[model samples]
Target: MKRRKAIRNIVLFSLGTGIIYSCKDKYEAIKQLHLKHLIIDTKQLDILDDLSRLIVPLQNIPELADHTALPFIMNMVEHVFEEKDRQAFMKGYQSWDQEILSIKGRAFSAMKIEEKQQLLSEVNEESLKASQELYTVFNTVKEKSIQYLTTSEYYQRKVNYYQMAPGKFKGDVLLVDLKNKNDE
Candidate 1:
C-alpha cells in the first residue's frame, strides 16, 4: 500500500514538473533581426514597429494590425542609406523613446494616437537640438514612414490616385472666353 502511494506521488510530481517546464516563458526574448547592413535587434525592431505605426500617414484606421512600414523603412536604411547615416540613425533610436517618456510620463506603446501626435509635434529640431540622437531617430522614422505610405500600393490606389496623362477634358467651356488668337 505504501509503495503504491509513493509511486502515485512520484508520477504526479513528474507530471507537474513537466507541465511547468513545458510552459512558455512570458518574458521570452524576441527573435533577432536579420538585416545585412543595419544592426537592430528584436527589441529595437518592436519599438520601431510601434513608431512606424504612429508616423505612417493613415491615422484614420483603428487597428493597423500588420500594416507597419517597418520592412520598407528597414530596406531603405539598409540599402539606400550610407554606413555613416545608418550608424547615426541607429545610435539615436537606441534611446529615443526616453525623451517622449520624460514628457508624456508613459511609454510610446502606451500612449494613444493623439498623445503620440502631440508628443511628436514637440520633438522638432529646436526641441531635440540638444540631443542629436533623439532628433535623428524621430526624423528618420517620420520621413521614411511618410515616404513608404505615400508610395505604397494601398496609398496609391485609395488615397492618391495616379495620373497616367496630364491633360483633362472640360465639357462646358465657353468659346467667348477662349484665349487663342487664332481659332483652330
Candidate 2:
C-alpha cells in the first residue's frame, strides 16, 4: 500500500513538472520573434518598443493609447528594408545599447526616459562617438517612426486634421504680388 502511494505521488510530481516545463518552453518560443531575414529577440524588440514609445509619446495622451509605431517599423524592417539597410540595422541594433552602456554606465532598461532621450539626441547631434552602423540605425528608426506616425489613423484624424475645401483661396493681391515678387 505504501509503495502504491509513493508511486502515485511520484507520477503526479513528474506530470506537474512536465506540464510546467512545456508551458515555459512555449512562452519562451513566443517571446522571441523570428523574422524572415532578421531575428529580433524579445530584448531587442523591447528596446525598439521603448524607442517607438519615446518618439510618439502615446502614454501622455489617452486617445493615442491604441496607436503604436513599433509594429509598423518591424514590418517595414522585415519587408521593405534592403540588404544593406538590414545589415546596418543588425549591426546598429547590437551596438546601440552597448554604446549607451559605455557612455551612461547603464543599460536602456536602467535609464529614465529623459536619459534615453538625451542619448538619442547625442546620436543625432553627432555628439556621441558611435559607429556608422549606429548612425544608420538611428536615422532609419527616426525616419520610420515619423513615417508610421504620419500614416497612422490617429495622426490622420486628430493631429493632422485637414478640412476639405474646393479650390483657390488666394489673397486679394495674388497675381500682382506674384509678378512683383518674380520681378524683384
Instruction: Return the TM-score for each candidate structure.
Output: 0.57, 0.64
lDDT, candidate 2, 37-81, per-residue tens: 665444666677677677666555566645556666766877788
Candidate 1: misplaced stretches above 4 Å? 1-33, 57-66, 98-117, 128-130, 163-184
lDDT of 2: 0.68
lDDT of 1 by residue, 66-150 (tens): 3566776777776789888888887766665665567557876577878777767677535533367667777788899888777
lDDT values, one for every candidate? 0.63, 0.68
Candidate 1 contains a number of clashing pairs equal to: 0
User: In terms of lDDT, which candidate is strongest?
Assistant: 2
Q: How close is candidate 2 to the true structure, as a TM-score?
A: 0.64
